[model samples]
Target: MTIEVYAMLKDYFEKQFIIKEQITDINSLKEYLSEQKPEATGILRSCRFAVDDEFVSDTYQLKENDSISIIPPSSGG
Candidate 1:
């Protein structure tokens, strides 16, 4: 399962560039993030998750070749 993470999530990932990863499910994805980037802790609390442009939750089941994105809160005028 290749997931496409967004750059806006860099804040939680130690400022690394957005990249794709192969994982099993959302749980594994969370674990992978925590391992590769400890800064991601608690970041997913208020984040919006999407799969293939559709909004989903962390418990959402992921499929092979799925594209996922984690978007943090933002403010604008």
Candidate 2:
């Protein structure tokens, strides 16, 4: 199964990118993110997690071919 991963917060200062990962559950996704970008650890903790555009918590279960997005706090003047 494939999952679509999107990053929102990090895009402000870095290149925005998406990931197409073969994974089964949220835990695996977390592990994958940790490996791909260690710097995202802190942001992940505070960021809002979502599945298929619906807001969810870290423990939310992910299904096959699900779309997941991490949206970090946004600030502007």
Number of the top lDDT candidate:
1
Question: Stretches of candidate 2 above 4 Å error?
Answer: 1-8, 11-24
Cα RMSD for predicted model 2: 4.0
- Predicted candidate 2 versus true structure: per-residue lDDT over 6-74, tens digit per residue: 456444324334556666566666777777777776666666767877887666777666666666677
Model 1 C-alpha lDDT per residue in residues 2-68, reported as the tens digit of each score = 3444556765554324335656567667777768767665665566767888987667877766767
TM-score of each: 0.65, 0.61
lDDT of each: 0.65, 0.62
Q: Name the runs in model 1 displaced over 4 angstroms.
A: 11-24
Task: Report backbone clashes per prediction.
Answer: 0, 0
